[model samples]
Target: MAEKPGSQEAHLSSSDVSAGQLVQDWSVKEERRARRKIDTSVLPLLFLGLLVFQLDRMNLASALTGGFATDIQVTQDTINLGNQLMFLGIVILEIPFNMLLQKLGPRKWMSAQVFAFGLIATLQVFIRDRRGFLASRMFLGLAEAGYIPGAVYTLSTFYTRRELAKRVAILFFGMFGGNALSPILASGILKLDGERGIRGWQWLFLLEGLFTILVSITLLFLLPGSPDTPKPLLSPGLIRFSPAEQDILQKRLELEDNEKRGGAQGQPIPLKLVWKTLCHYRRWPHFVSTFAVFSTWSPLTTYTPSIIVALGFDRIAANALAAVGASVALIVVFGFAYLSDKTNRRGLSVITAHVCYLVTLIVARQVHPHVGKWSRFGLWTAVNSFAVGYHPVHNSWVQLNCRDPRERSISIAMWVMSAILGLMTGTQYFRGNDVPFYSTGLRTMIIMVSIGMVFAIIQVIVYTVHNRRVAEGKHTSSDGEEPMIYTI
Candidate 1:
């Protein structure tokens, strides 16, 4: 018997619906697998690169007491001048480096930076005087400039805004891990003093610099520009991606980009983009907050070893003890980043972290040397961990607010420049007279972090208001794109 016309129509519609659902299910499954592949393959390589970057950048701190100043014949003042010049180099070169990364892509540009900075770092072993030392530091800074921002911008291309914060934390965990591990590594290498008639500090530079160069060669062969193109320079077929996976990743990002910015995702940045990014008054709160928080690293990171040594420990012991704070930082940074991503509450997480930092700084400043050294050490660890915890949240905030890719690239560069400028002021914080306690520097850090908290508050308020406006359709997007409604 023939089926009725109504029954036939109903059967055809149900079959179409089932077919669509099956396709959707398959796409979702493929995306999950692809993301897992990315997590394992891509993130670890990026983490390694960041680890190399931080090790090279922060080795100078470990070298301070290992006869660096004595061999170079520089006073604390001269060392401070060198630090200032280094940051000045970073400040001057960061934007250009970021623009170059945009032009050349991450693989070639980032690899070249690592190699150049590695060579500069290795050259440090030849510095015979304060002038030579200063020049090497400046050259190192110039070579390392834009690395963090460039890495961040590159990662943003692969991950969604939500997936970014935790990945950023994992990447920065390399820095914290380097801070924790480099002390041990440097101290062990310092034991190689007088081997081949080279000073321990000289060996430190030579070995660490060589490690950076080796890593750069690996990166040159591993990292391709985007997820779509997995072809590394030499690896040819190393990172194979199925067409289905590519379609899912690309389509997902396009959908997200459309929702966030009316599909203004991959447009070339205008020449006036920097001027426009700089003038966005709403972004200033984040900039101020980033600068204030990052500025603390000058006295905090650069001087931690010095402070420990001044507290009656020898250089090796001081370096070992400094690792404790870095250990704490690694824990807090990962934990805080996990929470930030889970809650989608960037501003609250940052403000809370800094508030904890403010308390720890106060306690560290109040610890009396005559009483006990352990209290001072504990408080310093707390301060370091809390301070480091604020970074991933702050970075994600800036990137999310500037949804456009080109805008994000330029804005990240500007943010990094602001951080470099803030850090340049760091050299002045620890003067020759500051010595053991550096009480004034500690107090200055407290005040600066407090100011940063204020900026964090302002950032939350502005972003909240802006989100509300977008929700209510009161104000359109500033860039003539769709207004994105997101939580801070």
Candidate 2:
């Protein structure tokens, strides 16, 4: 008593009214499961790429400890000027590179740029003059310009807001891990001195850069572009999802569709749009807050080893002490990011970290010379930890406030540009003549942190008001999405 294949009774019993509908339903379920597994598997490769990128970027500072200043015959200010130029190059190129990512995709364009930067960084071994150093750094900066923002945008595509902070922290920890290990790596490489007449620092750059180049190749093979795309690493069993899971995927797809339709209708993102969005007096506070916090932090990363040397540590000891700072930074960054995600409050996390930074700096600056060296070292560690925590919260704040994809991209670019500009200005504060215990630089950091706190408070107030307006349904936009207030 079996029914025919196309019979209504058979179709209803088996839930396959038509071949097309069955195929469509199965395809949708398969895609959802694939996305969930694909997102998880790609995280390790993402972490590795970020680790390599950060290691290559930061090892230069450690390498400098091994006769770099003597070889180049430049003062600290001049060396810092080179660093400033690198930041300037990054600012100039980031946006264009991000736009290129949109066109060429993150996997292809970002990985290629990473490999190019790695090759260029390795070429630093041949440079003997300031001009050569500057050129190499400029090339390195250009190579790195799109990497971070591209990574951030790419992660956003794969993860929801609930999952973003932890993943971002994980990748960020790789950067901090690189910073922590740089000195140890440099110490080992330093032993390879006089290999073909190359110094230890030269070897550091060459080896590290080669490592990055190799990792970039791996990243090209591993990173998935979108949820719907086939992932090479995902298993077939993981390629299905329930109805609720499909709904979550639909949100991202819909957003992308809207952006494409909007762009195709000749509605390019306008300068006026950026301005109008920023015209909200509330937005100014967050912008200023970001600038101030980063301004304080920039000097630390650029000049911490030099500062430790001034504290009477030998070159090796100075590099080791810098590693301690990196370790503290790694711990604090993850801890703060976790708390922020748990509480869903970017502003509070930022304020707490900055306040800790201000206290650490003040104590470090005024500590008695008679104090034990270990005590001073502990204070320095605390300062670095607090400073490192500042950036993640600030970035989260920006991401929260800039809910629109185009605006978020532009905002991140602007924020990075501002931070780089601040670094450029702060670098001059640490002159060669002020080598040990740069009093001027310390004072400027204190002032900047205080100012940053004020702005952070302002952001909290503005965010609250904006949320209140949205709840009242008084701030609807043309697209009817609550005017896209920055909410973490």
Candidate 3:
């Protein structure tokens, strides 16, 4: 029988196609039960890995206020260069490493990479020159390259698209926690200046690096595999799910994909998948927006403590105080993610978060120099509070626009690479040359942030137009197959 024009049944292969109705078909109660199990089993451990990832990399900034530069005989400019090279390393290897992760499975690959980076992170303690510092940064970046995308890919296999944003937001709390905690920890640890003849920064690296190594071991035992491969690397059915639960976990995702793919499912060859995913122009704004917005973070994160100190706080006080805003950001980002999931409005959520951040920045830039020290501190906190709240929401949005698992992997890798590239460019924003000119740094941040916001709006328009085409049946496969629907 021929399908009628503009009928949802034209695309819905299943009797129920909307996510809400599909949830009913999958059994709302059972989906909830399985998700609860997966949540407790999966998210916490991923958060641990992310926590350490943030700590391992961000410890450098904390080390700066602790005389790390003097010990290594390097200047702030050289440190910036090393930071730039570190992100360059991640960008170069992100895609290839993520592919390896998919091939080998996250169990063996992610576990091994965590251990590898932990070793590199600890080895930074021995660096006494510019060369060694540079070498450590590069090696650490290489080791950490694919972990984010790998985790996201793994999470995708576990959860439905609608559930992804909140989970991702939860996962990223690990990073935010690290950002908030690292400085506070450093303030106390840096006071151990000559403990056993080790400088404070060395102690910081050694203790934190060893802690990450232990976390790697813990994750090996605890991190759950896919629904079918339900055991962690070293576990013997420890985090195991029942057969019925596993069925729910895997089948729900497959069903959701069917609903989205409609009747136009064409499995592209590997090379073709790569090409098509790369050319999916609707996804470009996600990448560009990530690049621009994420660029604004490196300078702020790398210098926030120093900025605080410049506001008349002592180094130790600055380190502890720098954590305040990041702590608040956890609330902000989660609120955005939760509301986005509840409303099923990814674009509006992301733009709202981005605009909030930009408003804070613009207000800060205009009022900053005129303010008193405490007022200056408040503005800086506001700017940091909104920093990167859109990140996880943006990630979920990108994942939604992808057509297949292979495309998803590639798209996520591209998004993460864009973020790393942004960080790389931002390392130069507050280099030694711009050190004294606070306004110069603020201006650079405002420009990058505005560019990102523009791209984010562009992404909304792209999604809107594509969704309209799908509704009208104008969006078609090259072979004139039915159009696939995208979640806007």
Reference-based lDDT, each prediction: 0.77, 0.69, 0.83
Candidate 3: tens digits of C-alpha lDDT, residues 1-488? 32332333323333454544442234456667888888988888888899998998998878989989988899888988899888988988998887777667777788888899898899888999999999998988889998898888788888888788999999888988899889998999899989999999999999899999998898888887677677777876355677778766876776667533211112232667677778888789899999999998998888999889888999899999899998999999899999899999898899899889989988998998788999998998898899979999999999887766777888999999999999999988886766543688888888888899899888888878888987887777785656656667
All candidates in order of lDDT, best leading: 3, 1, 2
Compared to the true structure, candidate 3 yields what TM-score? 0.91
Task: Give the alpha carbon lDDT tens digit for every residue of 135-189 in model 2.
Answer: 8877777888866766766666666565677777776777677777887677678
Query: Ten consecutive residues with minimal summed lDDT in candidate 1?
Result: 8-17
Model 3 deviation from native, Cα RMSD in Å: 5.4
Candidate 2's clash total is 4
Comparing 2 and 3 by TM-score, which wins?
A: 3
> On residues 287-333, what C-alpha lDDT tens digit does candidate 1 reach at each position?
88888877888766677888888778888988888888888888888
Q: List candidate 3 segments past 4 Å from native.
A: 1-27, 259-269, 479-481
lDDT of 2 at 295: 71
Q: Which residue ranges in model 2 land beyond 4 Å of their true spot?
A: 1-40, 230-282, 472-481, 485-488
Root-mean-square deviation of every model = 5.5, 6.7, 5.4
**Model 3 residue pairs with clashes:** none
Displacement of the residue 483 alpha carbon in candidate 2, Å: 3.5
Error of 3 at 138 (Å): 0.8
* Predicted structure 3: lDDT: 0.83
Candidate of highest lDDT:
3
Cα TM-score per model = 0.91, 0.83, 0.91
